[model samples]
Target: MMFEPTIWIGAILMGLSLGLLGSGGSILTVPLLVYIAHEPEKAAIAESLLIVGIVALTGSITQFLKRLVDFRLVVVFGLPSMLAAYFGAYLSQYVGAQVQMLIFASVMVLASGFMLRPISALPNSNNTPNSINSRVDDFTVLQYLLLIIAGIAVGTLAGLIGVGGGFLIVPALLFIAKATMRKAIATSLFIIAMQSFAGFMKYTYLQSTQELSLNVPLIILVTVCAVFGVLLGGKVVNKLPQARLKQVFGGALIPLSAFILYNNV
Candidate 1:
């Protein structure tokens, strides 16, 4: 089996970021696969969905057992996202790889801006974590519409750009659905997994028809390393400052995005 320590290290950090902050893994995964592991951009994008989907699903399970998931929002937000992601992946075949990279890099820049914001700032002051959780059944027509629209936007980006779109999902849940940070983060993971697998399935169809290839062994190795890193990060999450971690990760993305833009343009 081909092995690269640098790639494994990136995987560990990608997973660690996810475990510590509940997001940011996708930003690392796609770059690591494409540049370090040297996978084709399209194939790397598809593989990233598989890797992140597995990790995000695993992370979401703990929140599930803790009863933190809002199933009503999951149905309203997740189902449409999944279908949209599938369609987005199908549409990807028409776009050039360089154009896709440009889109992904642009998204990374946007995601970094969101990460730099304070956690409480994501939701309005009136919608603090201490704010009482409201039933989805009580949501206004506009709120329901917001949830559905947010889901579709995040899902399309996930399929087109290979991002899990958790950065987008969490904020939408906080602002539109008024979910507390903890609940939004957990729910975001579940939605991302659904969107990712939907996109991956569509990509798999391309593999057969377009002569694209996925490096399954590389994907497996990266997934295993990332999961291990998640476990390690979980043990230290309480010891670390999540805000600082997000800031560092956000700052790091700036240069990485610049590098991608340089190459793509």
Candidate 2:
């Protein structure tokens, strides 16, 4: 299949979103794959898991080097998410394409609401070890249960719709783990890497008949371009005001969400 310029352009934008916002890019991947690349819904969803997983893993590694990730929190939140993501991927076979797109669009709306919140509303992190521990210790049993539930929900969404679930996971971490915004964002990347990989694996396993083969060259091309875009976004994110960035991205999502909903509906 001949690759369209829009595919590469979308890949760059997706990466830039991840690098700058840290969570919203994967939401765009499926649509780009389906509309611009003309991939089937199931195949696009499965491929999105791979793309998002790799990007998140790359970002997580960078966060780890910066000592921003909370491994314990990742374990607590990620295991259930991984399992649920697997189940979601398996179950996707029973779901219709239109239904899946509708679900995906709904998630975009929900994610947009989160992004629209003021950055000042997010918890501040000192980026200290003691502070991280204190936040974890403060979580009640009820919060732990909530974290598990949130994980399951996020993982299911990732598996079903091909999202990384960072939009959901970051807030869940803040509320349940009592993490700082930076830690929540960094840790969310790690969780996304694991859950998305699990979902991708499950999707592959269920494709026994191999009804659609993955576009290896296209995936490689998009991934590479996205990596570059993320690098550019990372540089720009530090220079931009956080609140302004959130407001801009959040406002953009409104119409994007509406477009998805309208087309799917």
lDDT (0 to 1) per candidate = 0.85, 0.82
> What is candidate 2's local distance difference test score?
0.82
Q: Estimate each model's TM-score.
A: 0.94, 0.92
- Give the number of colliding residue pairs in candidate 2: 0
The candidate that wins on TM-score is 1
Poorly placed runs, candidate 2 (over 4 Å): 1-3, 125-138
Which residue pairs collide in model 2, if any? Answer: none
| Model 1: pairs clashing at backbone N, Cα or C within 3 Å | none
Q: Please, what are the lDDT tens digits per residue for candidate 1 over residues 131-233? A: 5466899899999998999899889989987999887888888889888767777788788889999999999988887678999899999999988876677
Q: lDDT (0-100) at residue 71 of candidate 1?
A: 86
Candidate 1 residue spans exceeding 4 A from truth: 124-132
Prediction RMSDs, each to the true structure? 1.9, 2.1
Model 2, span 6-37: residue lDDT tens: 88888998888777767888888998888778
Instruction: Kindly report the root-mean-square deviation of model 2 from the true structure over all alpha carbons.
Output: 2.1
